[model samples]
Target: MVDPRRFKSRSAVNAYGGLGIGQSVTNWHVVGRSRASRRGQRAVKRVLFLAGRAAIRGDNALARRYANRLKSGWEDRKAIRDVARRILFVACAMWIRKEVYRDELVSVPSPTR
Candidate 1:
């Protein structure tokens, strides 16, 4: 599986380095907040959707569980938020560990399950 970190461009990596909210670069406040514009929200949604889709093929147990819920009639947008939440949760965990986001078996069952 492709490492999602590789998708981060050089600039993003630099941005991550300068990130003050936490250690993970992807943990930007705009991601979880209502501060972004409509277009920005759409973009973030796309990213979250793509990440959730990819997670189905990955070791991210949370993502897989979310995908399953999606298949069971949950709205795609809600499922995407679940993915975003998982992403943020992992990001926070990474921040606490002083490490970058790592692909792991996210042992917890998904909330939507």
Candidate 2:
């Protein structure tokens, strides 16, 4: 098996740093609603945010459609955060199941057998 994490350029990997929300490493707000506290690993937060944006950039992915659905009811950043949360949840499930993620399995919707 090969490592799934690969980038074509060092700058491409480093590019996410500039996308940071500039909050402390412990907590950051995607939406600062009253009485709502958001907290997580800042590095992971940035990656998830960037991943959401990337998903939105490409029109064909199911993730993009999911983001669009969320965007209709919320701000773009908030929608992306929702997508990021979904991504995080899916990732955690994959980790628990010991399954490798297949974008094909996720990106396209198929009929039930």
Clashing pairs in 2: none
Candidate 1, residue 78: how far the Cα is off, in Å: 1.4
Model 1 is weakest, by summed lDDT over 10 consecutive residues, at 15-24
Task: Supply the global lDDT for candidate 2.
Answer: 0.51
The lowest-lDDT stretch of 10 consecutive residues in candidate 2 is: 13-22
Tens-digit per-residue lDDT, 43-84, candidate 1: 544655576667766656666667676766787766655665
Query: For residues 1-113, could you state the per-residue lDDT of candidate 2 as single tens digits?
Result: 02214434423322332322223333554444232124434676678778877766765454655655664565566566555655655565575568987665554323222
Count of backbone collisions within predicted model 2: 0
Per-model C-alpha RMSD: 10.4, 10.5
The positional error of residue 23 in candidate 2, measured at the CA in angstroms, is 17
| Candidate number achieving the greatest TM-score relative to the actual structure | 2
